[model samples]
Target: MATTNTTTPRPGGRSARVQAAVHQAASDLMALRGRAALTVPLIAARAGVTPSTIYRRWGELSDLLADVAVERMRPDSEPADTGSVAGDLIAWAEQYRDEMSSEVGVGMMLDVLSSRNGVSVEGRLPVPCQCAAFTASQIRTIVERGVERGEPVPVIDTVMDTVVSPIIFRSLFGSAPITSAHTQTLVAACMKTARLLAPVEL
Candidate 1:
């Protein structure tokens, strides 16, 4: 008689711990050393896991880097809608900058870009698969709110190009402070343009 294999796996066990540790190590190394310098031995040494374990599980440098990138992302999609488009926009922009400015955050983008050459790191990249659905939901919520408020909503790509990308570039690459004043100015400019492009009610 042939029997089908039935095994229910439980998460949050030792394997989970090892994954987390290794992931954190990868982020740390990318941030401190530089993404181009990463290697399996280096990650294993930092993570305290055997190099073979990493090799067996990830198989390739790009795979592990991509996995760590996703793990480092915010668990929630966008922040809560603040009931107003400007309010929501500013809040989201500030939060996005703050997150990216952190040491780990800086490295996150580097690893992402380094791993995928020829892909524009210009504020447009594939959303990590795990968070893709959640991020979509968040954008929908923000857009729906704009519609209700009778506000002129810029396309999501526009926001990324104008608001998100600039701030992230400043935080990650530039020397200037990503201060509140700087981000506020950005928000104001985008909001003004959005209003200008919006249709006037008769």
Candidate 2:
């Protein structure tokens, strides 16, 4: 008789169950002990998977964190077209600021930024910044709408800077998070600089 080749199944098989358990455990640990206390051994023990599983899948602490953190963070969803560029822009901006200032949103921001901001491991950059990218798409959509109307829209980069930079600065540095009023004011101010930015009720 030939001997059978039987290998014990890897813990959780890299399926959704394993990933969910690992992700949940990682977050719970982060909340309890802070990022400084994170480690493969610690996470493995917490996640109930072997150290090899995490190492093979995630490679290192930063990579594991970036993976988990990105999974949890969500950017504001794109708003439906309101048939006016300024109106659309103001609506999206309000949603964006609200998302960023919410308790859940603030925690997500803290989780990602606190995890070394993509410092590399084995020369590999940490998790990609997909969290705030959806908001940028809204900006593009608004700018292109103005362009289509034959309005002299500012360049996309300029429009983004004019609209987003100050809001982020205030969110990160100011005593209070930005409000819908704040975003509306910025949107109105940016509109003042271009024909594409024609005044509209925000």
Candidate 3:
């Protein structure tokens, strides 16, 4: 007996084209006119799609903005290689703090949080979120590098919980300034955890 194939075909043709065009248009407009000036009609006009097209796909402006924010936050390159795990963590943490604490970063963070962000056509949530996934990928790189050099390193979740989460929480709530010193403090705590968790040789 022959089995039936149940795979969903990848999104393409007109749907893919429209999505690409709209994403590009939204990004360009956000850069040129800022987020406050954006509207579904303006983006549709720029993308050569009807406002209904966007509404049909994304449901609302906040969801559209969240999708765009996820795209914009995708990492273009690997985290900086600063030799030791501690150095790498320090560098990555400081950079992450600076970016996420900026006016634009804060806005993007809010956009991602304000909606479902990127839900697949199958209705699945992005789980860890695309932005958080990107951050985790960077941390994985740092951890792998440390392991390669025989240095003890905390797991990815340790870094995320210790360093990334605090920065995000503080940035979003404005509980404290995300200064370099604050980032360093977080990194130091992460490294301390790693040291304590390291296995003792027989």
Best by lDDT: 3
Name model 3 segments beyond 4 Å from true: 1-14, 116-126, 195-202
What's each prediction's TM-score? 0.63, 0.64, 0.82
How many residue pairs clash (N, CA or C atoms closer than 3 angstroms) in each of the candidate models, in the order given? 0, 0, 0
In candidate 1, stretches whose alpha carbon ends up further than 4 angstroms from where it belongs are 1-50, 60-63, 116-140, 195-202
Q: Using lDDT as the measure, name the better of candidate 2 and candidate 3.
A: 3
lDDT of 2: 0.65
Q: How accurate is candidate 1 locally (lDDT)?
A: 0.66
Give residue 3's error in model 3 in angstroms: 43
TM-score, cand. 1: 0.63
Best by TM-score: 3
CA lDDT scores, all candidates in order: 0.66, 0.65, 0.79
In terms of TM-score, which candidate is stronger, 2 or 3?
A: 3
Which scores higher on lDDT, 1 or 3? 3
TM-score of 3: 0.82
Q: Please provide, for model 2 over 35-140, each residue's C-alpha lDDT reduced to its tens digit, 9 standing for 90 to 100.
A: 6788888988988999899888777777678767666643324455787767877877776677666665565556556565454565533433454454455566
Q: What is the lDDT of residue 4 in candidate 1?
A: 12
True lDDT of residue 109, candidate 1:
59
| Cα RMSD for predicted model 1 | 9.6
177 Cα displacement, candidate 1 (Å): 3.9
